[model samples]
Target: MRTQVAIIGAGPSGLLLSQLLHKAGVDCVVFERRSPEYVLSRIRAGVLEQGTVDMLEQAGVSERMRKEGLPHDGFTMAVGDTRLRIDLNGLTSGKNVMVYGQTEVTKDLMDAHEARSAQVIYEAENVTPHDFETDHPRVTYEKDGVSHEITCDFICGCDGYHGVSRTSVPKAAITEFEKVYPFGWLGILSYVKPVDHELIYANHPNGFALASMRSETLSRYYIQVPAGTDVNKWSDDALWDELKIRLGAQAAANMETGPTIEKSIAPLRSFVSEPLRFGRMFLAGDAAHIVPPTGAKGLNLAASDIHYLSNGLIEFYGEKSSAGVDHYSQKALSRIWKAERFSWWMTSILHQFPDLGAFNARIQQSEMDYLASSHAAQVSLAENYVGLPF
Candidate 1:
């Protein structure tokens, strides 16, 4: 097979890039190691930065999102019993976020691909990119006991953290920065109305808790737990009891409990692999970096990666220019680092760090107090929260 671009991973990042490039008249093919069902089954964060929502629109896949997704002008931040709403719209001059699940976004992109009969190969085994350092890059994979190869002008790795794309590069060529948090988030999805209309991020004396939702009736909630905690240990009722304690008296009073549809514990980490480009192959999304979900930046960061990458590829094909692709790494990393910083800061302030002693805990409280009282602090938070300009 021959194509202009061979994309690895049919996740939102790769799918969005292919959608944009296709719309721009650039041919590309996507390869996924797992079936579409498996991909959609993985539950993820739902909060969308304004920029992410716009990019979905740009890709012509935001119809369902705009119709069903919840839009919020602000969200509340709680320190113990005190709550302060960060007015995202007022602080950012009407900018706000959309509460849309990552799963739905992927489904929309996948539907678009299917409707267009785009080349998206699922359940391809051993997908690998080779000769990315040369002018001609190709990808190889096996399906149903048959091996196949696709030669393309470039290769894009949106395959994620454990994907072959990043591992394909020599270790010495990539510099990795990572910090594993001391705790993990025990999250549950329930079919009950949310405690609040908008999301609430709470920092309690015990731990951190987040009350978020996918829709008016679908509640998603999380509470911080020690690292390596087992999901099987906590029953639905037990988890809800913990949430009540951490979210405070008022929120707990309003909170509705129900049978959880899904439950999992995910560890928090901040990781970035520098220089996203390696010759003709480039890394996007989780393949390039990861942020703790504290600031709801994981999926948004991926969308931003697709933005820079698709633009660069479009420029390369349309104008016969390599400038965009040449500087893809630098441009993407600049924005990636900022998001990493914001996610790190949000995680630091909201999560209970085991090693950070009581003095640091007081300092965290002071910082939250300052953020609540100071307009400048709120503005800064709102700006970063709504997302910086793409």
Candidate 2:
């Protein structure tokens, strides 16, 4: 099979890129390893930056989100036993986050793609891109125990950090920068209702915890845990006790822990690969960079990367010129680094470090204190959190 673009990985980045390109009359094929059911059922980032919501609406994927997603006006910052509310409306003039999972966004795009009769090759195995420099790059995969190849002019690697696309480029010329945190977050989705209407970020002597909701009936929450912690180690009752100690002491969280739906220990790290493109293949989303979850910027960054790549592709393929194409890497890097810095700042301000100088921990606490006290500090966070406009 031949098309204008051969996209690897059917995650949100690849799917959205295909959707945007197809809407512009570009031909593209998306390949995925997971079944449709697993892709839709996975629980991931649930907060949408205001800008992301706008772009999805313009892309015609926000119909269900608008009807079902919960929007929050602000969040509570829990430090010790004091809870300070940062009204997002007061900070950003109505900019806020919509509670909709990244998985949901992927499903929405997938459904729309199918309705348009778009080709999404699922259960595709051993997918590899070869000869990217030419107009006939190929994606080889196996299906029904038989191997096959799809040829295209360009290849897009949206398979994320663990994928081979970034490695496909020469390492000597590539520069990588990453920040790995000592701790990880144990996230759980519960059938119980959220303790509060808006999300809560609780800081304690032990660690940090967060209270967020997926819907009115279902809620999501997280607590800091040791690195490489296993999700199965904690029982439902045990998780509830820690959550209460962190979140309940402040702001009267009437949390009721129901059946545990999903639990995972997610590591905290920040990674960025420079020059997100090489030859005829480009990388986006987790394939390029990763951020700590404290700021909830992962999906938003992925959305932005694909957003820019789509525009650049339109410019390159439409006019038969490499103007935008030539500068795609540089253009994408600017935004990528800005996001990296923001994610780093938020992560550092929240999590505690062991054996640190007492001054350092106090400094972080002071910063949080200032954010609660100073409108300027709160607005700065509000801008980044609502997400850089798409």
Top candidate by TM-score: 1
How does each model score on lDDT?
A: 0.94, 0.84
Candidate 1, 242-305: lDDT as tens digits: 9999888888999999999999999999999989999999999999999999999999999999
Model 1 score (lDDT): 0.94
**TM match of model 1 to true structure:** 0.99
Off by over 4 Å in 1: none
Among all windows of 10 consecutive residues in model 1, the one with the lowest summed lDDT is 76-85
lDDT of 2 by residue, 1-390 (tens): 788898998899899989889888889999887788877886788888887787788678999999999998787776654567878877899888899888879889989998999999998888888987666688898877999998888899999898878888888757899888889999998888788889888778778899988889888889999887878889988888888887765434587767787888899999999888777899999999998988788998888888788888888788887777678788778888888889888777666666546898788777777777788888888888887664
How many clashes does each candidate structure show, in the order listed? 0, 0
